[model samples]
Target: MRPEDVSALALLLPGVVEAAHQGHPDFRIGGRIFATLWVEEERVVLKLTPGDQEHLLAEAPDLFAPVPGAWGRRGWTNLDLWDADEAVLRDALLAAWRNVAPAALDGD
Candidate 1:
């Protein structure tokens, strides 16, 4: 997957929008960031639950990792675009979206 591919997939989720954040593009829902693209690094950051982050990291170390330090401990994760396909990216993105999405947006 590429940065554009990640952005495309992230925007596919309901109520999602892309915005600039600290020189990078971030995906958000209800004004809260769910994911961010690091174009030059070929990676994306997903705001996930600690459990979800652990599962993904344990399952695919090459594809997922904590963002490092305090943020990572709180469930911020880094995903390597080159190591993931659409299905994997989509699932991860959905999880991130849901993590921050409003209650009314749940279960859809």
Candidate 2:
């Protein structure tokens, strides 16, 4: 998948909005960023739980990794788009979106 593909998937989530953050495109739900497109890096970053980040990293190191520094410590992850699988990407996006999406939006 590419950055556009990631952006498109993120926009599909309910209440998701596209905005710029520090010059990069960020996807948010209720104003909380869930994903970002790091254009120069050619990577898509997702807001996941630390546990999920570890799991995904271990499961697919070639496609997923921690974003680095404080943000990463707080569950931010970078996905290598060129090696990412569509199904995995969709699942990852949903998980990230759900992390910030209101409970009602998630049917909870």
Candidate 3:
């Protein structure tokens, strides 16, 4: 999916907010970012669950890759839009919520 589509889908989550600071799109809950749309890079960086993260990278390293810099070793993954679509993109947002939101709110 395109960045704008991801931005729209992100808004469907509860307590989610969008902010444009430092010239990039940030989707947050409780003032913390769950996903980000890098305008310059045309990429969507999402925070995924630890177990889910490992599974995706190990199973489909080509479709998803680790985010550079901070959080690389944590639960962040990057999706290249060349082969991306809304269904896969929406699942990425769900994964982002699992990483950024609290376990109490995630329903275990």
Candidate 4:
């Protein structure tokens, strides 16, 4: 999928807002970042659950991975290359919300 497609799907989550700073794209809910992205080099980094990084790596080793440095151990996965469809990203992003955001903040 394209970056635009990812952004579009992310916006579907309630209360999600797109903001850019430090040249990175971030998705926020309740004024907090649920997902952050770096489009340079065609990569989208998602702040995910600590339990999910290994699962994603084991399942889609090539497409999903942990973010480098401190986040790598905490389950932040990066979606490298826009090679997948919106469905995949949607699920991943929702997972991120489930981890970092309160359900109340992500309305209908």
Give the Cα error of residue 52 in candidate 3, in Å: 2.1
lDDT by residue (1-108, candidate 3, tens digit) is 577787889998777889875678889988888888886666787788667778877866777888776686787888775577778777878888767787777787
lDDT of 4 by residue, 1-108 (tens): 777766887888777899975778888877777677677666677777777777778878889978778878887778875676666788888888767667576453
Pick the winner on TM-score between candidates 2 and 3: 2
lDDT of 2 by residue, 3-48 (tens): 8888888888899999988899999988899998987777889999
lDDT leader: 1
lDDT of each: 0.92, 0.89, 0.78, 0.77
After best superposition, candidate 4 residue 4: deviation in angstroms?
0.6
Clashes of 1: 0
Which residues of candidate 3, in runs, are more than 4 Å off?
103-105
Q: In each prediction, how many residue pairs overlap at the backbone (N, C-alpha, C within less than 3 A)?
A: 0, 0, 0, 0
| Weakest ten-residue segment in model 3 by summed lDDT | 79-88
TM-score between candidate 1 and the true structure: 0.96
Residue 54 in model 3: shift from native, Å?
1.3
- TM-score quality measure for candidate 2: 0.94
* Residue 106 displacement in candidate 3 (angstroms): 2.8
- Predict model 1's lDDT versus the native: 0.92
The TM-scores, one per candidate, come to: 0.96, 0.94, 0.83, 0.87
The prediction achieving the highest TM-score against the true structure is 1
